[model samples]
Structure formats: structure tokens, C-alpha cells
Target: MGSAREALLDAAYEAIVAGDWTGARMADLAARAGVSRQTLYNEFGNRDQLVAALVLREAERFRALTGQAAREAPGDVGDATAAAVTAALTAALDNPLIKATLTDDTSGLLPYLTTRSAAIMDVFREDSIAIFTERWPEPAEHPEVRAEVGWISETAFRLVISHLIVATEPVETTSRHIAEVVRRLMRDLTTT
Candidate 1:
């Protein structure tokens, strides 16, 4: 993205972090970004799109970190999966936007964040698919194996998301358990 576009997104994110998305105006964002209102509109079209872009961008940042965790892990699949999932959960919990959207009962953005946030969802799903494929390329050659792993990755990611929002268990424990399940599933696919 151009500097102006990046600035606009950054300013919008700041507004969301402040829980002032409703109060945030094109003029405010433009001022924060050191751009004109026309420039902001030219980049994002409108506030809704700007918010969507912010969410997507933030989600992408988390996914990038998650992918890095996967890439940087040192041992086997279980260890690596644990690292990756833990990283994602940690980032989500730390991110102000995720915290605001998920934890704040009165957040006006909750409905849209939950129901219309396909871009955010895809960050986890697509990143998991890519990382799993990269780490276990042999499975991709088999259609059924690929499908099974995809399901496993999606389910594990959902568990991470749930743990982040609901917190039935400690994030570490839940992520570790999910990683074990994923490893077991992969072993079954290979052995049977």
C-alpha cells in the first residue's frame, strides 16, 4: 500500500482502539493521517470499507506472526503446531481490536465483527492451510489426506479462537491439547 493508504488505516485502527469508531469521522481520520478527506475516501471509499480494511489488515498481521511461529518452530509437527496456535491465540488476546470486539458486550462493532468478518476468518483458515501444506506437503498429494488435514486445521483454529473469546481453559493448555489432536490425526492418516 502507499504511504497515504497505510496512514489512513493506521489512523482508523487508532480510532477503533479508542472505542470511538462511531464517533470517528472522515475528517478525524484524515487529520490523523495527515491527508485530506478526499484522499481518505479515494483510498478506502467510505468508513465501512475503511473499518473492514483495518480489521483485515490487523488480522493479516496476526496471521503473519502465526505463520512465522510455524516457520520458526524447531522440532516435529506437534511442537510446531503448538507454537503456531499458541502464537495466534496470544496475538488475538493482545490485540486491542480483538479484545474490544469480543469482550466488550456493548461494542457496536460486535455484530459486524462476528457476522461479516470473512476477511478476518480467512486470515486464520488460509494461513493454517498454507502452513500445514508447507510443513506436510506429502499429504497434499492425497486428496483425502488433504481434506482431513484441512478439517483438522480448521477445527484446531476454531478451538484457538474459542479459547481466545470464551476461555474455558488456559490458552496454553487448550492450544497444546489441540496440537496433540492434530498430530494424532495426522498419524492416523499416515498409518491407516
Candidate 2:
């Protein structure tokens, strides 16, 4: 049953990544997962919920990857924090699902990505904050450090999304700028 659900989610995600979100009908998703439409509906409730679930799943994956990067990066807390932030942002922008969400303006995916919802921003914030706390352990005990980590993480995501969706700059340049911004933010946080 879990495998069936995961299969459905994977199908839906592939549809979205392929710029076929509009074509990702419930019947097609069910067929792709080798389940009936009734089963898909029973499992996911509706298309919006499915989309939210897919995005949330991807966000969690991104958080995990970022946490791993933080753990592996050899540096002080400040450098590790910056490296994690950069890695996460770069990975997100490079992800086919995320790129489709942010770049395909013809689709509603971008709006969905930024929309405020119980399953979207709220879940992302909670997960990311927890990951940041774990990654930057030095800041976990300090209110100031905690606040700075939260601010930097959120700001970095926002900047990256904006750059990808609205700005005309090349991706490499934007990524570099974001990395620098994160590094400076972390340096300041460590010093103050």
C-alpha cells in the first residue's frame, strides 16, 4: 500500500517535472501507479492535495540533502551554514521539479510553489528550521543564533526563488551571489 502511494506520487512528480501538470489527470496518475482512480482519490483526496504532497515531499528531500551537506562540509559553524545554504539553494534550482515550478510561468506551478498553505510554506518552514537547528548546533542554544539561522535560511530561499522566477540574471551568477550573501550573513551572525 505504501509502495502504491509512493508510485502514484512519483508519477505525479514526473508529470509535473515534464511540464505536464495540466495533463496529470487522476485517471492517468492512477494508471501510472497501476491503481484505480478511486484508490488515487481515496489516497490523496484531490488534485490540490496531491500537488501539495508532492511539493512537501520534495522539500523534505531537499532539507535532508542540505543537512547531509552541512554534516560533511569541513569548516566552522559559519562556513558550514553557508555551504549548506548554498548547496540547498543550488540543488533546489537545479531540480527538475523545482525548475518546472519556478520557470514554467505558463503553468500554475510557480504560484502553487509560493502560495501560503498549511502543507506548503508552513511545513517547509518547520522542517527547514528544524534542519537548520540540527545543522548549526552552535546556534541551537542561543536565541540570537536561532533567529539568525532562520532569517538567513528563509531569505536565501526567497532570493533564490525570486532570481529563478523573476530575475534575468544567469543561474550561475545568481547562485554565486546567493552563496556570497549566505556566507556574509553567517559571518556576521558568528561575530555578533
Candidate 3:
């Protein structure tokens, strides 16, 4: 959050974008950030920690962007969910890190977005739960409803992630379909 820390993360991100994470050096990143190597180490502890920080930051950024989209979307829950997915896909297309990762299949950064995605998932899960709660307003006594919402949130997140990694359709079509699925799931929950 501090300027120095943010700068270091930016530098690290730029390095990863320019080439791959394996080629990124702590010293080079420090220089790019206009900070000493010691400063970078002090801020991030080590390379792995720095990498995690960078990945988590990007995940948080994605969540924030998509959350805003869902909030601003018109119509009902289905429409908002569609907007969120659309925003996510659009943002991914414009993200340099995502572009680089996709182009360089061997970047080894895919784990951050895939298998090792717990932190990223957690970020989205929290936001999704809040949004779901706001839209549905399940009472505290209705633990089953809350559990259903949590399941839906995770399902939606996995769907989004799947689309990000492997696009089979247009963004609009994919988002609309995802929204429909979400709406149907919510409808089922309400009806039962």
C-alpha cells in the first residue's frame, strides 16, 4: 500500500510481463522500483513472498473491478452477474500480466491463477458472499440458505476461472449463459 511497496510490486509485475517470472531478479526489480535490494527484501522478505504478494494484488484488483460492475449493472441478479463476468473477461483481455501468461504457456505463473488459487478464490469468495447476501438477504436462522449461497458463489467463481483459462464462446454469450445458470440456481434455492 505504501508507495515504495507498490512500486516494488509494479516493478516485479513489469518484469514478469516483459519476460517470465523465472528470469525476474530481485536486484533488477529493486532497481526498477528505484529502491535498494535491501529495501525490496525488507518489504517482501524474499522472492516467493514477493511473488505471492504480486499475484494476490492482481487477484484483488480483478475482484474489485468485477464487484463494481455487478453493483452497477441494471435489471435483476442475473443481469448483475452477467455484467460481473463480462467485466472480468474484458479486464483479463486488457491485463498485461494475463496476456503475458497466456502467451507464454511455460511461464510457471499459471499455478497462481489455477491450482494455487486459494488466495485468489478467497478474495472473490468474500466479495461474492457479500454480494449474494445483499441480493438475497437470507436470515441467520436459515443456515441452509446461507450454505447454498456459499456453494453458488464458489460455483460461479470456478465457472469464471474456467472461462478465463479456456474460452469456448464470445464473452457476451459466455457471460449471459453463466448469468442464466446463476439465476436458475438461485431460483431453485428459493423454490426449495
TM-score of each: 0.84, 0.73, 0.91
Mark the regions of model 1 whose C-alpha exceeds 4 Å error after superposition. Answer: 111-113, 134-138, 188-192
Better of 2 and 3 by lDDT: 3
Best by lDDT: 3
Q: Lowest-lDDT window of 10 residues in candidate 3?
A: 132-141
Alpha-carbon RMSD to native, per candidate = 2.5, 3.6, 1.8
The 0-to-1 C-alpha lDDT of every candidate, in the order given, reads 0.77, 0.70, 0.84
- For candidate 3, what is the TM-score? 0.91
How do the residues 1-192 of candidate 1 rate in per-residue lDDT, one tens digit apiece? 499999999898787778776777799999999999999999989988887888788777877888889879977667778998888787777788887787556546665454675566667876676677676676778777777776777667666666766778777898789889878877777666
Question: Which residue pairs clash within candidate 2?
Answer: none
Return the candidate ranking by TM-score, descending.
Answer: 3, 1, 2
Q: What is the lDDT of residue 5 in candidate 2?
A: 80
Q: How close is candidate 2 to the true structure, as a TM-score?
A: 0.73
lDDT of 3 by residue, 1-192 (tens): 399999999998888888846776789889999999999999999987888899889988999999999889877667878999999999998999988777777567787878888888888987887776666564234777777877888888889889989999999999999999888887788777
Model 3, residue 132: C-alpha shift (Å):
2.1
